[model samples]
Target: MRARDLVTDFPTVALDTPVHEAARLLAAQRLPGLIVVDERGLPSTILPGTQVLRLAVPSYCQEDPALARVVDEEHADRFLRSLDGRTVREALPRKPRELPVTDPDATMLEIAALMARTHSPLVAVVDHGRLLGAVTLQVLLDQAVGT
Candidate 1:
């Protein structure tokens, strides 16, 4: 199968999308991550859901198990409130990384290899410079298992 054949509708967020809003969409859609598009509507980055959670939970909580237990949901939620003024760009990792992308004509193996190399949950299928859709890990696995 080609990457285009596995492509499915997926959410895309703008670089300026509010961090909190993006997190809500990620959770609501049950996605592992979101495709961050640039001003020209080209895929720019991948924002992993784990990164969102990392921002929501305090560093102290992550560093110490005991401190985490002391934090209630209400308190934990306060950390997320800090994301109000932040944009998706602000939430990106400090190190730059290429967004996982595949041509529409790419084979499934090529898509899977790219995903594995990038450690991304989904790979964007690009036709020229435009993003057509994404091939998610689940979809790749389903194809691999002949589902």
Candidate 2:
């Protein structure tokens, strides 16, 4: 199958969107990630849900595994409050990883390889610099297994 055939509805957010709001969307929809669009509404980056969780989680918890047990859901929720004033662009790494993108005509193998190489959960299908939609890992897996 081609990328165009696999494209499906996906969430998108602006670069200036509040981090907390983006996080809520990710959680509410159980999305793998969001397509971050530039001011011109062009897909510029991919914000993975894991990256949002990384920001919510405390460094101490990551560094010292024991500290994680001390953190309850309430505490974790409070920690995410720090994202209130931050924008999605601010949450991204200074040197963000490359976004995985494919043309509509790309084959399934090509899309899968790009996702694996970029370690991305979704790949955007662009047509003449415009984002058509995204192919998620679940979709790819379903196609692979003939589901």
Candidate 3:
């Protein structure tokens, strides 16, 4: 299958998208990650769910896993409040990397290779610098396994 055939209408977020809103989108959709788009609506980066979770966690807990167990469930549940007033751009990794993007006509193998190499959950299918849609890892695996 080509990227065009595999592409689905996945969610996209802008740099200024609210962290709380983004987190809700991820949770509601149960997505592995979100594609961050630029002003021109081109894929800019992949914001993995783990990265969003990282924002909810306190640095102290991250530095010492043991500390997480000490916090009460009520307090722990409130961790997501840390994301309040933040934005997607602030949640992005400090280091920038190439976006996992593929051409609409690209072969499934090519798309798979790109995803594998980048360890990305989704691949943006662009046609001549314009955003088309995305091929998610789950969709790719389902096709491969004939499920």
Which residue pairs of candidate 3 clash? none
User: Each prediction's Cα lDDT score?
Assistant: 0.88, 0.88, 0.91
Better of 1 and 3 by lDDT: 3
For model 3, how does the per-residue alpha-carbon lDDT over 1-147 read when each residue is reduced to its tens digit? Answer: 899999999889999999999999999999989999999999889888888999889999999999999999998889999899999999998988777998989888898899888888889999988888899999999998899
Residue-wise C-alpha lDDT for candidate 2, range 1-147, written one tens digit per residue: 999999997879998899999999998999999899887666788878988878777788878979888778787658878788889988887896877988999999999999999888999888987889899999999999999
lDDT tens digits by residue: candidate 1, 1-147: 898789998889998999999988997989989999999888898878888888877788788969988777787657778778889988899998877988889998898899889989899888988889899999999999999
Q: After superposition on all CA atoms, how large is the RMSD of candidate 3?
A: 1.1
Error of 1 at 78 (Å): 5.3
Better of 1 and 2 by TM-score: 2
TM-score of 2: 0.93
At residue 140, give the lDDT of candidate 3: 92
Candidate 3: count the clashes: 0
- Candidate 2 residue runs with Cα over 4 Å from true position: none
| RMSD to native, candidate 1 | 1.5
